[model samples]
Target: MIDEVVMLRHGRTQYNLQHRLQGQIDVPLDIVGQWQADQSGYALASRFYWAKVNRLATHPESIAQPPAAAAERTDINQYCEAPAAARRMVVISSDLFRAQQTAHAFADLLGLEVTCDARLRERSFGQWEGLTREQIKAIDAEAYASWKRHTGGETRYGVESRAQVGERGAKAVRELIQDPRYADDETSTTMMLVGHGSWITATIANLLELDPDGMNALGGMRNACWCRLKVRHTINGQPADRPLFELEEYNKAPAIADSADWENGPADLRGSSMPDWCPIIW
Candidate 1:
């Protein structure tokens, strides 16, 4: 059986609202961001129901009551049996607060513990840590543009080179899979990795064997978006291989309403409101 992996970006942050480059900065989720995380948990719960349906169908004897009678059971416990011996699940996240928080939400829904791995943190921006693109241009326009165009260059401005980011991110993911907990599992498992935009994008591109230019064209990732991957393992003791880790989903969180478009005052607001604490990315 193959293992399934779910990659989720963190929720909105203060820097995201102000258009700042957050790289490695630890920021907490805003109120709306927290709500979105909760909603994500709910979505996972719905998926759990469908998974249960599939599992139950595979074992007819387990159902004492008739199909119609079982369907009428109000409690979800009737369908919450453990998966077959051939399946398992796990959740992990970067040590960063944002990623940790997002993983926490999903862990709650899956009834699994979250493991924070330091190797999964975002790329270190070095000197460019908190500056926005416009700000970087003002400081060193030529160098910034050159860095963007070139594949690898000197990190004079304290920014991480694209190649380095990709290398580190990929290494982290490889290490995680090699861990005994995941490697020894005979059953298929679902693993969720919550991390930053650039690092996650670079890792995905590397896993797919895409060139640097191709990854660049893919552009920035949106908050709370996710990617999915399926990794296949040999029935024998050979090393596991990933046939493909395709982009199964993209940006999907609910959009925040523009306050300026509202005719009524804030008191009468009925639409989605942006979180006051975090910066809105979109």
Candidate 2:
């Protein structure tokens, strides 16, 4: 059965660097984006070894600290030598170029193939697809004001509403868990869904029955970063009709890339252009 889900946001693109609305434009990853994806692959795989020693956050100290004593060293080496067949790792990605690129990186490391799903595409921004905030303000002042105020602006201007994005994304996830190939698996499965920012937030919120509107309570996830969720088929030892997910980690960057992160808790200038605010549409 699928034991866990990792929702990873795509690496940055030219549009992301420009602070423009990517929507369904399907932009390619920039140079730094490529580095982020490559490093994430190494870090994610190393977790199989580090997880027994450290928490899942992948913070700066995860790789820096040494074993306390000889016994601890032996334990870590043994954990690293565990048989690979104990678990299965798979990657599922949005059909968009950016998401697919990131997925391929992680899949290559695990020697797996990437399954692309169009439903995981970013929320359609309609007429604002390729425009920046400044351009949007100049074109449609009223719509811009409502969006800035976070009062359901996307519902207007032909853009896809939050509910619409949430519905499609959540359905995609639920269907995957029900599909026999994954749900009926003999070994535990770790499935990573590489997708866009807004779609990931909306889909997860909808899954958890939280408000999938405006700002996300879990906050914006950084580019090439991921959140861990535990998939449960039972509650209190009783079988559940459907799968339930528990949030284990939220918005954790790869420890290998920790040096690139700013003290402000965002990536450097070359990383994702997500401002403290322009989080949703971009």
Candidate 3:
């Protein structure tokens, strides 16, 4: 079976909190961002355990033998043996610091080495890097409007074209999937790719064959958010030219409750109400 690929967005950064365009600039995660990374690690570990349990439940007879024994058993009855623990999982990330840090958390949890590749870096914002949306509008109204409209004329400002970013990002992911070392194994394995929100989202949309406007409508990915993609094998019994990429799951975060009301006391401050102080993970 083809390995499952999990795509993750890096944890929050100072630029994220300030609503600035970070682009390829390197930024470290904030303290709260580290907490998010810890949570994501815990969540992934739980998923691994859950998958093991489900596999065992579906093939009760396989549990009677040791894992090593089951591996050698060729009986048709043993065909449903539970998948082995996914020890071969791999994690890859953008060379950018924030993405590297986020990938490290998962690598540590799984005891896997991370491979940093430049192709995974976020889309180059060119001149737009470090500027907030408001600042961009105030400073370069025409360029800002052009970007918003998805026009192809923004290259002069140094921002990468959306189509080019998607194509390049998808190419990198496809190369990993086609690597013989990953594809030859029958045991289920997983690979995690950590990158910027926009770049990852665009790459996913392209792989899923979503249209340009549909891709844009998919919106930005949240910090530490993930999307699970399943690659379907080809029907002709030949290696797939373009693997079928299906979105199995998407953006889920640990729940948080509002505590401001409890601390502030119940005075009806209706019209003058202030925003809650709860830390936003996205």
Candidate 4:
């Protein structure tokens, strides 16, 4: 099985700018979003390089470690380094246009191709597909209340349940992880999935074996941000039956100068108006 999987959220879209629910809409990336995708590509490329640098820095047989502990982890903060993992990675994306576009940028940078999968798509919001937060609150008060309460067996305007979306996303990822194409003796090969914030959130919770109620507990990834997960195939003396997706990091935006405000708005809105938080990536 692959050792690590990086789950990245798609870049910003017009809907995002309007603070609307995109759902499964095939919206294209905005100008700022495109720039974010490019920057994220470079950032993703640098990760492989930084990992190698860290290995070299930590080795007793290699050059002496840097004097500062903070400097020891091979900083590529400048974002000009070439990708070290140019090969040995399987890049996959949600079939939605935004995710595909974001995945393309990173895949092109790493000399790989994007494989599209519908299972990785964002949760469907049915009639609420492109509605803004205010619109949803005013028009569908009851649905909004149900959503906030996280009640099951009921969906607003036939929207897909978080549980349903998470299960689908989790199943797709688990199958991909078990694929033999990415396995290697080095055990450092990676799987990268570019997807929507809601879908990624649900997927992560599912991968961690959490129930539906815990789906959004960790929150969603911000536009162009990612979370790293580590999984093991075998444990103790037997093949692991139920593997654990250990979260290494969450909601990291390497390309952003300030990511403190890059949080999913609608998820936290909870039947209320949009918050004052805004993405500062641009």
Candidate achieving the largest lDDT: 2
User: Would you give me the overall lDDT of model 3?
Assistant: 0.70
* True-vs-predicted CA distance for residue 5, candidate 1, Å: 1.3
Indicate whether candidate 2 or candidate 3 has the larger lDDT.
2
Better of 1 and 4 by lDDT: 4
Off by over 4 Å in 3: 49-83, 214-216, 236-238, 255-282
lDDT of 2 by residue, 63-104 (tens): 334557645432343333456435666678999999999988
In model 3, what lDDT does residue 146 have?
Answer: 75
Candidates' RMSD to native = 6.9, 8.2, 8.3, 9.9
Q: Mind giving the per-residue lDDT tens digits that candidate 4 earns over 114-204?
A: 8888888899988888987568778867777677778842374878888888898999888887667756545456788899888888888
How high is the CA lDDT of each candidate model?
A: 0.65, 0.74, 0.70, 0.73
Q: Write the per-residue lDDT of candidate 1 for residues 1-282, one digit (tens) a residue.
A: 336677788876667766677788888876445555655656664554443343444444454554664756444344555343245556789999988888877776545578888888887888878887778778887776776776443278677776678778777776777677755555556677888888877787777676645534456676666677776555366664643455665544433323222112133323465433333232
Model 4, runs deviating above 4 Å:
49-87, 152-154, 181-188, 212-216, 259-282
Q: Of the pair 2 and 4, which is ahead by TM-score?
A: 2
TM-score for predicted model 3 compared with the true structure: 0.75
Candidate 2's displacement at residue 3, Å, is 1.8
Q: Pairs clashing in candidate 3?
A: none
Candidates 2 and 4 compared: the better one by lDDT is 2
Model 1: lowest-lDDT 10 consecutive positions: 256-265
Deviation (Å) of 237 in candidate 1? 13
Which is better, 2 or 3, measured by TM-score?
Answer: 2
